[model samples]
Target: MIYVIIGILILAASFIWMEIAERRIQEWEKEK
Candidate 1:
């Protein structure tokens, strides 16, 4: 059960990171 919770947290964090990275990339493209 603890492992499952940890896995979910990691997945959530990675998803958020991906979203942030995507936004940054878009901003960079606009700047260029």
Candidate 2:
């Protein structure tokens, strides 16, 4: 059970990080 919770947290963190990276890329492209 504990492992399941940890796995979910890791997945959520990675997903959020990906979203932030994508937004930054979009903003950078607009500036160029």
Candidate 3:
């Protein structure tokens, strides 16, 4: 049960990171 919860948290973190990275890339492109 602990491992499952940990896995979910990691997945959520990865998705958030992915969204942040995408926004940064979009801003960089606009600057360019």
Global lDDT for candidate 2? 1.00
Residue 3 lDDT in candidate 1:
100
Give the TM-score comparing model 1 with the true structure, all chains together.
0.88
Question: How many residue pairs clash in model 2?
Answer: 0
lDDT for each residue of candidate 3 in 1-32, tens digit (9 for 90 to 100): 99999999999999999999999999999999
TM-score of each: 0.88, 0.82, 0.93
Choose 1 or 3, whichever is better by TM-score: 3
Error of 3 at 12 (Å): 0.3
Task: Name the top TM-score candidate.
Answer: 3
Given candidate 1, what's the lDDT at residue 32?
Answer: 100
* Lowest summed lDDT window (length 10), candidate 1: 1-10
lDDT, residue 31, model 3: 100
Tell me the spans in candidate 3 whose CA falls farther than 4 Å from its real position. Answer: none
**How high a TM-score does candidate 3 get?**
0.93
The full ranking of all candidates by TM-score, starting with the best, is: 3, 1, 2
Q: After superposition, how far is residue 24 of candidate 3 from its true place, in Å?
A: 0.1
- Superposed by TM-score, candidate 3 places the C-alpha of residue 13 at a distance from the truth, in angstroms, of 0.4
Candidate 2: residue 14 Cα off by (Å): 0.9
